[model samples]
Target: MQTQIKKWGNSAVVRLPATMLAQLNLSVGSPVDLKTEGDRLVIEPSLNREYKLSDLLEGITPDNLHESIDWGEAVGREVAA
Candidate 1:
């Protein structure tokens, strides 16, 4: 289905048809990556960049709950001091 391009203030906006929107799984406020290929333009969804566990774990410190352990009397002795 073909859609019409209307004048929006200082720029022209293309109102995508309902069929094309449904086929492309696009909705309002969705980010689109537009590029020019030869004489035509291509529009698609942008790649979502996500952070890793290292990013989320920044400035986090490990607990030292076992700092009171004692192993001086016997080989297998691990009594908490």
Candidate 2:
């Protein structure tokens, strides 16, 4: 994806096509993180970053006993089953 960097008003910007943006799961105001992963520059939607469920649940207590199942696999099984 060789995109030309062009001048945007006062600063330079790369125009991401709508298709490309959507493929990358990006939207007009979606947050993104920029970092050099290994040797390549990686640009991805910020929300795609992985966070532990425990981190998100923080102080919340599970009301039921079945909530302890690993959600990713559980969802996969539920969908596949």
Candidate 3:
């Protein structure tokens, strides 16, 4: 499939067809990485991985834990310890 790059404000943009996006499981506002491979332009989904709170907490251990620092006495209406 071929697409035309059109001028959008000061940037050139290509409108991908809905069918193409659906095939790739992508939609509007989806993160994507664009790069040039040789003479062809390549567009792929970003490799950003989402982390779960539970999974992150499981990775914490006493070996990597640190003690909290005391920031002196609170002058304003801060929560008391």
TM-score of 2: 0.45
RMSD of each: 15.2, 12.7, 8.4
What is the lDDT of every predicted structure here?
0.77, 0.75, 0.94
For 1-81, candidate 2 gives per-residue lDDT tens digits of 798879988998777799998887778988877789799877767765687988977756566324555546454445754
lDDT of 3 at 18: 93
- Model 1 per-residue lDDT tens digits across residues 1-81: 566779999998888876777888888778999899999878888879797999867745576333566546755546555
How do the predictions measure up, each by TM-score? Answer: 0.52, 0.45, 0.59
**What is the Å distance of residue 46 in model 3 from its true position?**
0.6
Better model by TM-score, 1 or 2?
1
Which digits, one per residue and each the tens of the lDDT, describe model 3 over residues 1-81? 877999999999999999999999999999999999999999999988899999999998999988999999889889756
Which candidate tops TM-score?
A: 3
Per-model tally of clashing residue pairs: 0, 0, 0
Between candidates 1 and 3, which one is better according to TM-score?
Answer: 3
Model 1: how far is 80 from its true place, Å? 38
TM-score result, candidate 3 = 0.59
* Segments in model 2 whose C-alpha atoms lie over 4 Å from true places: 37-39, 48-81
